[model samples]
Each structure stands twice: as C-alpha cells, then as structure tokens.
Target: MKKFDVIIVGAGLAGLSCGLQLSSKGKKLLLLEREGVVGGRTSSYNLDGMDVESGFHRYIGYYTHLPRVLRKAGVELSEIFMWEEKIHVRVNDEKPLVLGMAPLFGMIKTIKGLVGNRRYLSLKDKLSLLPFFMNGLKDYVMSPHKLDQHSIKEYAAKYNVTNRAFHHLIVPLSSGVFFLPPERYSAYVFFGLLAPTIPKFYKMRVGAYLGGMTEVMCQPIADQIIKNGGSVRTHSNVESLVIEEGKVKGIRLEDGQVYRAQHTVLAVTLYTAKKLLKPVFENHPWFQPMFQLPLMPAVSFQIEMTKPAVPIDVTTFAPFTCLSSFAEQSRTTFQASKGRLSIILSPPEKFLDLDPQETLQFIIKDARKIGLDLESNILDYRQVNHEYDFHSLEPGFQALRPTQRTPVEGLILAGDYTRQPYFATMEGATLSGLKAASLIK
Candidate 1:
C-alpha cells in the first residue's frame, strides 16, 4: 500500500546508483531488496578479523564513471591506494612468469618476456595479438557495438592465435575477469577490455576501496539516497509485477502487499528480471532478449594464514589451474596486519559441488604452485558461490541483450547485462543504473 514516484527492486550497484541519482534529481523513489544488506556482489563480509569481499574486485583506472559516482557520495578516490600493476601468470608446472605493467614503454618489456617464454608464448603468439593492439582505446571501448558479431574463440582462430597463446595468455586474461573462456565470449568484449588497458597497459594504477567496497562504495550510495529523501527497504521481496494492458501498474510482494508507483525499475540481476517480468510482459520487446542472455556461477576462496608469502597485489593463474585471479588484500581489508589474508577467484569448474571444507582444502593444494600455503598456518577459511550472477558473453548472445530502457512503458531495466558500452562489470552496473535513472529524469 505504499506509493512513490519510482519503485526500484534490488539495491545492488545498479539499483543503488539509480536510486541515488533519481533522489538527487528531486524524485521520490522506494528501493527494495530481498537481502538485509545492499551492494549485491560488491558487498563484503568480515572474516577472521578482516574484511573479505564476495570476490576479487579491483578498480581499473579506465573506469571513468565509478570514480565520479563515488565522488558524488562524498567519497574521494584518494582514500584508496593504487597497486603497482605486476601480474604473475603461471603456465602449467613451469615457474610463474611476471609481467611488469607500469610505464607506457613497459608494455614492450612484458611483450619481450612473452616472446621469450618458450614454454608458454613465442614471437608468433606475441605477434598474433596485433589485432588486439590495433584498435585505439576510444574506438574499442566506446564503439565496439558495430564489430562483426563473432565468438572470441572464432576471432582468435581467424587471427591464428594458437591454443598455447590462449591457454597461457588469453584464457587467464579473459576468464580471469569475465568468468567465461574465449569460446563463450564475444570478440567485442575481448576488445572492450584489451582496448582500455593494453595500449598504455598500466595495471599499476588499479585501486581497491580503502575500507572494503560495500563500506566505502555501496554504503555511501545508500546514505546519499536516504539523504536525498528516498526510502531504502531491505528484506522486501517483490513476487511479481502488476501489469495491465502492456503497461506496468505496480508490484505485488511475496507477502501480499501491493506497492504502487508511477514508474518501476527492475534493477536486479538478469535472471531475476527474466523470472519476474517475462510472465507479466511476455509481448514486450525486452522479453525475448532476456531469455537469450545467460548466467554464470562462480565461487570465491578466502584463506587466512599466520604469515604473508603471496606478495602480488593481483595475479592470474594459468588457464589449466583451478584459480583465475588471486589477491592478497590485508593492506586494505584490515586495520593492521591481521595475518596474511587472500582471496581466490575461480571458475565454476574449479569448485562446483565441492563442500566448503573441500573447496578450501583444494585451493590450498593448488596454491602451492605459486609458493602460497595455508595448510599449517591456516587460521580461518570460507568459501562462497554466487548462484545468480550473469552469464558472460556467449558467442552471439551479447548482441541479443536489451538496452536499459525497455519498450514497455513505465518499465526500465538496470543491470550489468543490459546493453552498455562498458563490459559486464561493476562499472557496467553503475552505467546501467545511471542509464535507467536518466530514462525517468
């Protein structure tokens, strides 16, 4: 029985950003979430006396909007410290090779390392990345919509990028961040990521929130939304959309409470949006595309040890390994040295169906490849799986995604999966949220 100018479902990055923007623009909005806390996957939890994120999250300097959104919430980017961009990629049983990404000219240094990497990449493999390097940063990241729709695997084959190149270089890079391998992703997404960081390729400038992402990013957004006269309700689930004559009427919650609004923003993940909106608005243009988009499942391993051994800020293991990216974040996650704590991001194939104890033990065994161990010094550990995360760009599936503004009247979509210039990521989530709010602005 509540009424507002706008009703936002799911207080994730997209929903929170949309609510904050709408409220600041003098609009009355109600933000609802099924969970007691907000921020979606960006949320963090305290474990072993340290703040551990849901997954390994790092802010690339190329993300132009994340900084702006944080500043609007009275936070400064300087609050977080920049990490030197040194990536260690281990290929099979061979020793890990380190890529130094600092000065603009340092790209050549890393390329030389790859070329000389006889066991992993060679001169031919290094030359195969010419297409990835040819696209200018502006064109690749901003204008990738027009590229011929092709799977990243297919595109790599056309360029003669060998499997060795893929297993050692491309897979770790693409799947490390995107969750799916080159075969499932679109070439545009590959270029979308390579465009921003490859030319100058300064990974050292990446930043992590000074006090965890939720406390520093999501909490501030929620605080601003409330300060602007908006109401954020947690543990409130909307069962279905109230539809009549192809237009959104309101929403009916699972508890039989009907909340009415002039406009409704479905800012949840793609899966939840499809479940709620399809049956209600079957004929809407957004319906068919929702089915085409996919979802991916992943797990994170949090390891607490008595001492520090893993020194790299961000490192990607080989494609054959169970882990994709590993980060040791004691500097940002704790008040002081609370023993060396690390986060391991892995694809579903690595930890699927494994119990928490089994998952933790498995990762510990795998960590030995990189000289990281917690078997003896293990103080605490936790494993989490994100069941409803979006599917990475699967072949031609990326093109079928709908934009933020749906064809249906009074309905707007906000999620990383919604078609946007940025790749599906936290930045994409923020942009999608802003785009949704702009529709009502």
Candidate 2:
C-alpha cells in the first residue's frame, strides 16, 4: 500500500504542469499515467533516426504558460527558437494572407472578407467593428465574462461580416485554436486567441524546442516530479475510480491492484472521466448533464520525407484540405539532420475516412497545392486519430463542463478538457493542471 499527499493522473501537459507546481512545494505526489510517456498530445516519436511530433505545436511566448513551467523545471529559454513574424494563411478562393506585425494593415485584412460578402452585412454593420478592432483587445480582456456565452459565428454575424471573413480568417484562426468548427464554438474561444493578436509587451514569436517537444518539455517535468519525492507509474491502466462514502478513496487498476490517495485528479478525457467516475456519476444530479456535452474529435497525420518537399520555411495556411494551418518542422525530424524533410498534415473529417494510402495521397496532393514537391519525395508516414482529443464546446456547452472542483470532495478534474479559457492547447492543459493542484489541500 502506498499513500500520497496528492495523486495526479494522466501525464499530459495539464498533469505535468500540476505536478511541476505541486512538486516544487514538496508535496508527496504520485503521478499515474496509463501510457509509458509524459507528453500527451504534445509529445513526439522516433522513426528511422527521425524525431516526428504528434502534431504541429507552436509556442507563442506571450499566450502560452508552458514557458513558465519549463523555466521552473530547469528548461532554458534560449534552448527554444522564436520566430517573431512567420504566420501566413491561404483560403480556398482568396489570396494567401499574412498575419504579421503591421497594425493598420492587419486590421484592414481582418475585416475585409466580412465586408466583401454582399448579403451578410450592411455598410453600417461592417463599420461598427472598426473602433473595437483598432482599439485592440483591452476592453475585451477586461470583460471576458461578457463574451463567454457568445459564439464566434454570432459575433461575426452581429458585425455583418461575411462567411469569407468567418471561414477563411476567423474560422480558420478559431479552428486552429479550438480544434473544432468555428460555427459550433463559443465566441470566448475566439476572443481568447485574438487577445494576443493585439500588440504585446514582450516579443511576439512562434517558438519550438531545440529537441523534440517530448525531450524538451515532457521529460524535464517528469524528472522534477521524481526528484521532488513523487512517484510516477506508467502502463498502470486505471480501471475505475474507487469511491466510498461519496469520496474518492483510491483507484482500481486493470490488474486488480488498488492505490489509495487523499485526492484524485481525473485528468483523462471527458469520456474517460465519465467512465471512471461512473460509480458516483450514476446517482449524482450534475453527472447526467455532463454526459450530454459533445466531445470534439481531432485527427492528425505526419509524413516523413527523405528529401525537402516544401521550399517555404513554414506556411501557416494553405488552400488545400480542411486543414486550417500547416507548419514546416525540420528541427525535430532526425531526417532533417541527414538532408530530409518532414511535413505535418492536419486535414479535416473528410480525410479521416480515407484509407492510409488514400490519406497519404490526399496529403501529397494538398502539399503540391502549397508548392511542395510531394511526388519526388520518398519516405514513410504515421497517423494518430483520437476522438477525445478535444471536447466539442458547442452552443450551451459552457454550462455543462465540469469545473476544477468535482462532485467528489477528494477528486478534481484536470486535462485540457476542463473549463479553461483556451481549448485543445498545451496552454489550456497546463492551466488546468495548475488550477487542479491549487484546489488540493
């Protein structure tokens, strides 16, 4: 039998961030991960001497809390490279758009598509966004509470913006942020992402680890968790949460081993949380409401190439597939060290139905649309399709999401799935972990 002051489940960004904070306080902690790795969605893998990441992840220094956690865990800032102005987007029919540091030009481009749609907005309606758009996001951030209930589509419609503006600019931006369709997502998700699009105090740049994300971020926090008298158990699939007297007393492993702790953080997916919390969730009044909430599905595929495919450094947006954005990640691919290229393909649901070979063919076709030499390149590919990657925060979903505080006294909810300002991002996961740990004791 083993006991801990706090037991953090799931080694994802949220769990790791929570562990990082609590471990520093010297709390006897136990981090239980079903997988053998620490990085959840933000991790990477090795293939034929190449380091391939699960998806495209870029750290915007200002908006991301990951840097702070990394610094505390002994990760140096210099170890990561920052690209200040490197984001571009291309819509299906429109010209490729650049999102850079220009203030006035950026504003014009942001709302141009909205104004262009003839039926969507009146002259008066399109002009109204000018003040708020130009004034930056101070008013919005000061009152984020007001925007929480509104959908991104509603806001765009209210402003008389066209679907071109919504789909190409705002939708893609919001989709990349929430990993969900913009029409079905909350306005708060969009506002949160656009908040940083305004001018900032520090430099605005996209960042990445010198090594793969798993090595640079996940491994360090794992070491700190162990160094601070905490134990981490991987491959320990948790069968169910043990509850008695309306409290989380312990957890039952698939193999019948029982581990008890004073507190348990249900840091898995929304579906997994429901299953593990079934004992109490069956009778609890609030549980039924949670079950109705929709969980968003996210699927990503990675293609490895023996030669360079795309000449561009990194193209955030391309007019191919349902993918909102794409990035050229060379530093992580071991193949890059040997004059090879690796491209990450993030297509929409249409591509998910395609067979692996078909998916690969679609990606190659789309890559060519972006001026990538897909035909000449020769290599391997890998795909990961997880339905629980994100919880679909559809209309009225905000009301049903579980909070950091759960119905069970000793159990708290973690993971990016929790009610965080940002959704389906490393920052959101880290924030959830920190909030969960703060609730303990």
Candidate 3:
C-alpha cells in the first residue's frame, strides 16, 4: 500500500489533463494507466517505421480553452500547423464537396459547399435547416436548457429535412461528434457544440501538430507532470475504487496493489466509469445518471502507402454505410514522408463482430468513395479498437449527466464523456480535467 495526495485513475486525456492542472497547484499525485503506455486513445504509435495516430484528431478553433492549457504545459503553438480546414465530404458516390473551415470564418463557403451543391441538402432541406442554422445557433444560446428531449431526427422532422440531408449533413455531422446517428442522439448536444456561445472564442483556427499527437502533446505533458513532482505509472490497471461510507478513500489495482489518497479522480471512459462505480452507482441518486449515458465503440484504421493515394487531406462519410470519417494523416505528422493514412470509423455495432481482414476490406472500400486507394499502398499498417469511448449525445441524457464534482467527499469524475457543454471531445476532456482539479482544492 502506498499513500499520496491524490490517486488519479486512467492516464487518458482527462486523467493527464487533471494531473497537469493539479501539478501546477503543487499537489502530489499518481496517474494510473491500464495499458503499457501513458498516452490515451488520442496518442499515436510507431507502426512499421511510421508514426500513426490512435485516431485522426484535430484541434478545432472552437475548442477555446485547450490552447491555454497547452501553453502552460510548454507546448509550442508553432509546432502545430494550422491547415486550411477543408473537409471533403463524400455523399454516396456523388462528387465530394470540400468545405474550408480554416479559422472557422467559412460559414458562407460551408453553406455554399453543401446547400449550393444541392446534391446533399436541397433548397427545401436548407429551408428546413434554416431555423436551426439561422444566426448560427442563436436559439440554443437563448434557451440552453431546451431541446435535450428532442433527437436530431425528431427535430429535423419539424424542419422537414430530406433523406439526402439526413444521410449527408445530419447523420455525418451527428456521428462525427456523437458517435450515433441524428435519430439516436440529442439535438441539444449537436447545437451546443456547433452553435457558438462565445463567437469570438469559438471562431478560431483548427490545427494539428507537425509531429505525432502523442510525441508532441501527451508525452510532453506526462514529462511535465514528472517535472512538477507527480508520478505516472503505466501497466497499472486500476480495478476499483476503495470506497467507504460513500466516499472514495483510494483505488485498488488489478494486481492487488492499493494506493491511498485524500482525493481520487476516476478519469476512465464512460463505460469503465460506470463499471467501476457500479457498486455505488446502482444505489446513489446522483450517480444513477451514469447508466443513462450510453457507450459506443470507436475503431481506427491505418495503412502505409508506397505511393500517394488520396490527393486531398480529410473526408467524412455518411452517404452509404453507417457514417464514418477518414483522413490521409501523413501530411500532419513529423513522419510525413512515410505516407501514413488513417481513418476513425463508426460503431462496433456495424463492424465490431467482423473479422480483421473483413474490417480492413470494408474500410478500404469506404475510403475509395473519396478516391482513397489504400490497397495500392505497398507497406505495413495497423488497427486499434476500443470496446467503448464516446458518450451518447442522445435525447434525455442531458439532465442525467453528472458534473465534475461528485456527491462523494474525496471522489470526482473527469472525462470527455462526463457532463461538459463541449460533448465528447478533447475540449470536453480538457475542461473536465480542469474542473475536477479545481474541485479538490
């Protein structure tokens, strides 16, 4: 048994962010990770002499608070390149529409790309999406508490969204964030993220590191924690929280090691959080909402290319199979010359049960819609699958989401999936970690 000021569970984004914030306060802490490494799902790995990422993630301008945290951690903004946000969307086999997001001042081009194309969203569909898109989310800002009960599908019906709009604009965007289709996820979470509460802050730039996200961000932050007198242990899978009298006294690892702390931050995924806290969650009123938060699987695929495949950078899909997002990520990483391409596909429900060969083939076929020819690539590759990660942005879960401050005296929650206005993203995770750390002192 060991004792510390705090025992942080799961070294993912929320855990690391919480540790970073606490370290700045001069609090001694321990970050425990189950895997062999410290980087979370967002972290990258070396595959076949090429650096590929856990997922193709970008730092969106609307993230608002992440830049400040990175600066404090000594991460140089110059190392991150702000690529023009050109999202090439493929609606079925039709022509892919490229929408430039860059500094996020591209609303007109975005509307023109989709609405003007009139292939994805028709004039009728734009008229339907008008009330929601008008003023860029004014209604959501006006009544922040409303629309949680309405799914995107239900809300779209009021606007009479066409099948093309539902499949192309609605489902693709909905699954991109919520991991569920528009019919399944809530309309409020969608608007809350896309609809800017602070237009000044929300209207920023989207960027990626010139190197691996792990090498550039996660590992650097981990080193910062060590520099600030905090301990981080990998291969330390935490089994459960040592709760007594409705308070978290510490945590127990799978190997039977016990680490005691005055405060504990359970920063694992939403599914893992519910599982670990099941003993209390089944009974506690405040914790009961943990069950309301549904879990969804996330899968990432990558391939090394001997020759250039897709000329464009990124493409999101929904014109065919369950919605998916894919990108030729080699351009951003320090290992750009290696020509690494990757994609973050949809639910385990659609492909989780498929064999590895079948899965790879499926993704390759999907990528071809945007002119991505991974099969022609002549090098090594890899795939990463997690049983759960994202939270359901679905209807009725808004009122159920718990905040960073928990009912237990020494316990707190920190994760992208936890209650955050940002939804399940790096922004939500960063903010959650900040709030969790603040709650302790």
Candidate 4:
C-alpha cells in the first residue's frame, strides 16, 4: 500500500484545484481519476480535426482566482483572448432581444416592486436583503447567510419580480450558469454572484480562449500539478474508501490495489460522492436523504462547418425552454480547413427525453429565429449529454448539500454540489476544490 498526506478522488477541475493548492503548501498528495484525462467537463477533445469541449465552458475576467492560479502555474494569460459578451433572451418565442448589464428595465421594475408593495419584498425577507443593497451592498458577498434559507425565485416573487422580465432575463441568466432555475436556488448564492459583477467587471467582456477551454485553462493547470510534486493518476477508479475509526485512511481501487493516505478528498459529482460516502453515512437517515438532492442535465451540439456564410461569433442565452444558455465559438485558425463553430445548449430537465436529432432540429430552429444561419454552412456534428451537470437547487435545497468537512474525519467533500455559492460551472468547481484544500492541516 502506498500512503500520502492526502488522496484526492476524481481529478476534475475541482480535484485538480484542491490538489494544486494542497501540494503547493508542501503536502504530499495522490490524485486519482476514473477517466484517461483530468478535466471533468472543462477539458477539450479533437474530434475529426476540430477541437471541441463537452459543453459551453468559458472564463470570465472577473474570476480573479482562475487567472491568478493559471499564472502561478506558469501559463501565459495572453494565449487566451476575451470575446465581447453576445447574450440574448426571447420572451414567448418572439424576436430575440439583446440585453445590457443587469437588464436595466427589469431591474428597475424589481426595485420598484421591492419598495412599493409588501408582496414584492416581505417584511422579514426585506430585512435580510435590504441591508445588503442599502447600507451593506458593497460587502454583501462576504456574508455566508444572505439568502441561506430562501430560494432565489421565492425572493423574486416576494418582491413581485416574477414577470416576463424575471423569467426571460433573470431565470435564463441564473439557470444557465448554475443549472438551477432562479425559482429554486438560494438568495445567498444569487447575492454571491451579484457581488462580483459590477459595471467595471461586466465591461471587461465575457472571455474565452483562442483555442478551447482545455488549452487555455485545464491542460496548463494539469502540467503545474505534476510539476508541484502531486501525481494525477487518470483511469484509476476508487472502489472503496478505507476508513479507520471513522477517519479516512486510504482508498481501494477497483483493480485491487490499496493506496493509503492521511486524508481523502471526494471531488466527484454529487451523485458519485453520495455513493462513495454511503458506507460511512449508511446509518444516518439524514445523509441518505441528502444524497438525493435533485440534479439537472446539460446537452450541447458541436457543429464543424464546411464553409462559413454568416459572421456570428458570440455567446447567447435563449429564454424559451427553461433552457439555460448557448455559446457560439469561432475556431478560426491559420491551418484550419473549415470554420469550426461550437454551440453549447443547456436544455431544461424535461427536455432530456428528446434524442440528439430532435435536439439538433430544435436548436437549429431557434438559431434561425435568433438571426443565425444554421441550414447552409454545415458539415459534421457532435453532441454530449451530461446527465449530472448540477443538483437541483429548488426551494428547500439549501439545507441539503454536504459541507467540505463530512461526518467522516479526513474524508472531505468537493464539487459544485457541495455548499457552493454557485450551482454548477467551472468557477464553482474551482472554488469548491479550493475550499476543500483549505480544510487540510
């Protein structure tokens, strides 16, 4: 048996970030994964000579931690370029409307509702949020319980802001990023996102890599983790976590080897984490129910065109299907033979029943409606269905997610599902991983 200070399971973005942070502190670590690669969904692949990602993944300039970590790993940020944010929303399938920061008119109405009517912002709820926007808005992100107990939609409804503006604008925005509809998420999580997004922050433009997210972020970070004395073992699945006296001691691989460690980080998705920790929390009824937190799926259609006709090169959000967001990436390379366009679609949970062909048609129709040419410039296509993108953050989910420190000592939890401020995204994963490592001695 091999032993180390920490053994991290699932070297996804979250695990990798935790590994990097812990290893940098001189902690001996062993990172394991069930896949051949490290990136969970953030990694990219070359499909038929075109670089593609699992879904629409990108980095925002305001993600200070991501850029700083990449720089520390010896990566050049200049390699990645920022694209102007090109997001849009449609109300009831009418013309897609372009929007500016905060959807000013919608926000104004929300503010008015909050002030004029008791139905908009309840007396009790007002007490919770008013302080943040009035006397304490600047430092609200630092608060742990701003919306800790209430759902985002509940907050909006309480303020009488659940109109078409809230649904098409706020719902799509939050749901697309978090995989949870606004009506079901915690107000605190929403507040956390709003805290960082000032006008200055939005003006930097939502950014993407010149190539793919893998090249710009994940790959470079993997190089750094290996260099920092941490081992990233892909395709090494942990069948069982060996614990001693309620403390994680090691993990037994499916292939029959036992790698021991002082601490273990379960950085798999929420569903996976539930199974791995089941043995430890089997007797606890609370934990069993906690394991069943609702989840949403993510699907994407990657199209590599034989030729280009339209000059559409921006990410957009469609507010129709409880659908989250759509991102169009232009892969214009010097050696490129044809135009490479990637469309990431986050359909609502109910839409999971549709097959790829149906999804393609649906997206194509929507694309045409949104002023993009989808019929002419087409070659080959690829689709991915991530059934477990995020746990459903519906009302009453705030109290269900696990924490970084679990009932089992040394068996830490790390994933976007675990008490993260955001529901599910690259940033959320990174933050969850970083938080897990902080729990280490």
| Candidates' C-alpha lDDT | 0.73, 0.67, 0.73, 0.67
lDDT of 3 by residue, 133-234 (tens): 653276566765667878878877776667666766777777765456567777787788776534754355456657777778888888899999999998
**429: Cα error in model 3, Å:** 0.4
Off by over 4 Å in 2: 47-51, 91-96, 101-151, 162-168, 196-203, 332-347
lDDT tens digits, residue span 248-302, model 1? 8688888999988889999998889889977876675557777767777777777
**Winner by lDDT between candidate 3 and candidate 2:** 3
Per-candidate TM equals 0.88, 0.84, 0.89, 0.81
Off by over 4 Å in 1: 46-51, 92-95, 102-124, 131-150, 162-164, 198-204, 283-285, 335-337, 340-345
The better-scoring model by lDDT among 3 and 4 is: 3
Error of 1 at 71 (Å): 0.6
Model 2 agreement with the true structure over 74-139: per-residue lDDT tens digits: 888676543434466654334355554323334453345444543334565546556435432543
The Cα RMSD in angstroms, rounded to one decimal, for candidate 2 relative to the true structure is 4.7
Write down the RMSD of candidate 4 (Cα, Å).
6.3
**Alpha carbon lDDT of residue 361, candidate 1?**
66
List ranges where model 4 is wrong by over 4 Å: 46-50, 90-96, 100-157, 162-164, 179-188, 198-204, 285-289, 308-310, 321-323, 332-337, 351-353
Model 4: which residue pairs collide? 120-158, 120-159, 120-160, 132-137, 147-188, 152-185, 153-183, 294-392
Displacement of the residue 165 alpha carbon in candidate 4, Å:
2.8
